[model samples]
Target: MTARTAALAIAMAAALATVAGCGRKAPLDTPYQAAVDARKEAERNKEPLPPEPEKPVADKRFILDGLID
Candidate 1:
């Protein structure tokens, strides 16, 4: 193929890749939910329960922090 045709092919491939990557992403389940699911699955299989997931700590920023910007 001509150099111009090869360059066009590469450009089209890159554009297609960019468009594919822009598709909507799936939402992830929270850690607590994941732990619950694991517990349920273990119960169904008569296996030992897995360790609980740790709770997320809340940020302790000062009240005035929210006033900026």
Candidate 2:
């Protein structure tokens, strides 16, 4: 093969190798990702998600009483 043809073939091979190396598993394969997907599936099935504790709200009456007393 000519030098130019050999060089072109090498370049094409290198490009193919680079592309072949880029195959990756989907994020859903990970535990955290699986949990996220499961949560989404539960929501789609209308299952209630676990509730978070409510944050405390500032009571103006308590604050005012504290200030007065």
Candidate 3:
């Protein structure tokens, strides 16, 4: 291959290697790991999950009369 093409290929390979190395998950995976740890902790503590709140029923007449306004 030509010298210019060889140099370009080397540069591209180096750039790809740098990006691949930079993409390591040790730093970015902390939050997910923490979440998993927290879930396990909650399970260990035998904490029950909170109940869902009840939604209010809409008053159709009040809405039509603009009483909500």
Candidate 4:
């Protein structure tokens, strides 16, 4: 094939590949989209996820109010 024709074909292929790639969204596109969706679903169901951690328990044993040691 002529050099000019070959160059044109290569250029067209590259352009087509670039255009094709533009339509794909990476799994992590929004990063937190999955978390947001899960939160919405949990809110709708009025249920907390099992793996969620609870706040630390406060110490109620007793503490000296005004001790200096």
Which candidate number maximizes lDDT? Answer: 1
Model 1 TM-score relative to the real fold:
0.41
lDDT of 3 by residue, 4-68 (tens): 99999999999999988875476464544566666677779998633433445654565457654
lDDT on C-alpha atoms for all candidate structures: 0.87, 0.73, 0.69, 0.70
**Winner by lDDT between candidate 4 and candidate 3:** 4
What's the C-alpha lDDT at position 37 in model 2?
A: 68
lDDT of 1 at 1: 100
Candidate 2, lDDT over the whole model: 0.73
Which residue runs does candidate 1 get wrong by more than 4 Å? 1-26, 53-69
By the TM-score metric, which is better: model 1 or model 2?
A: 1
Q: Compared with the true structure, what per-residue lDDT tens digits does model 2 show for residues 1-69?
A: 999999999999999999988976654375555566667787899997644334456556665687767
Candidate 4 lDDT tens digits, 1-69: 999999999999999998888855665634255666776788899998534434456656547744733
Query: In model 2, what is the error at residue 3, expressed in angstroms?
Result: 0.5
Q: Estimate each model's TM-score.
A: 0.41, 0.39, 0.37, 0.35
Order the numbered candidates by TM-score, best leading: 1, 2, 3, 4
Off by over 4 Å in 2: 25-69
**Higher-ranked by TM-score: 2 or 3:** 2
Q: Which window of ten consecutive residues has the lowest lDDT sum in model 3?
A: 49-58
Clashes of each: 0, 0, 0, 0
Q: Which should have the higher TM-score, number 3 or number 4? A: 3
- The deviation in Å at residue 36 for candidate 2 is 6.0
Candidate 3 Cα outliers beyond 4 Å, as residue runs? 27-69
| Candidate 4 vs. true structure, TM-score | 0.35
